[model samples]
Target: MADLPRILVITDRTQVRTTVENVVRAVCKEAGCTWVLLRDRDLPPLERRRMAQRLREVTNECKAKLSISSDAQLAADVGAEGVHLQRVSDIDGVRALLPKGWIGVSAHSVAEVRLAKEEGADYVTLSPIFPTESKPGYGPPLGLETIREASAIGIPIFALGGITPRSGFSCVEAGAYGFAVMGTVMRASSPGKVIRDYAAAFATSSSRA
Candidate 1:
């Protein structure tokens, strides 16, 4: 939408006390939440499609972009805005399939960030900037400098993992284009407050944030 969204809510039903649909609808009531990645990796195609359809409507109502994780064809079929690819995913193939929408990738380091940039990813989620309980095995946190280094790849880089409203500024200081998170919005009891906090942090440091 603006090259990329400033704040993205990564969805996971297991991580939240509420349903994914409810969480998306709740946090996206404001303009701060510009993106949602529907990441239910365990559901069957039909069930996931139905869920995506429900989320798609909510995103539309809020004027936010909705993307499904790791499924280009399914994303297209479900009327999502685009697809977010895995680290080892075939970008060229997915790009061919999704010739008309946003295509983002997961990256863990500077090399992968460069790869995504070189291979033409619309944006990349450079993750585990902090040790996160949700991603115990994604390697140790990369810290702020790694984020600064990765941002040189010339693609929009979103800092992921253990991102709270308090920590979002560190990402901006480290040169993150924005931040992507799950629990900050999903598990939040006061999701609107957290969302606004994130927006404020991003905005204070960025013109578009």
Candidate 2:
């Protein structure tokens, strides 16, 4: 897998007042975001593929990477750099389908993270790191300590759920390789600024380290 970006922006068109394409363009072009995970699962397959293809063009124009969530076939069809799978997904199946492509898995616990690593996932998004209105049923926040623990398992961990620009450095300090944000950037009036802030936070953390 290629070196993963420091920020992974998950798209949710319903949460955005503006168009998803506009936000993605802003983040990729202005904020220098290198990775985008298309997560509009509620859309019909045809519609979702159309959206993915559109976003792929935007990302490609900005020299960024695009990953389709839970859809290896769509990722392949649209020439995405990766496929982000649900925890219950068959990693091997996706591997066979997209042999050279990146594979990211959603993991809620250290056990799941370890399992994902064992199954050859290139990275994992460990979610509910803080109280998130976006995924209330994910239960309580996993806290920074969990980030520390999960990162020790030897796979890159992207802190997810309720992650904000302000909290980016904290997750990095706790050993997270990056952050995965949805609602924060999706609902932002200036999505580029949010992405820039996240980059700034990571930069600050690196300087301190």
Clashes of each: 0, 0
lDDT, candidates in the order shown: 0.84, 0.91
After superposition on all C-alphas, the RMSD of every candidate to the true structure, in Å, is 2.1, 1.1
Error of 1 at 45 (Å): 2.2
Query: What does the lDDT come to for candidate 2?
Result: 0.91
Per-residue lDDT of model 2, residues 31-97, tens digit only: 8899999999999999998999999899999999999999899999999989999964578888888
List residue ranges in candidate 1 displaced over 4 A.
Answer: 30-32, 206-209
Off by over 4 Å in 2: none
TM-score of each: 0.93, 0.97
Q: Candidate 1 versus the native: TM-score?
A: 0.93
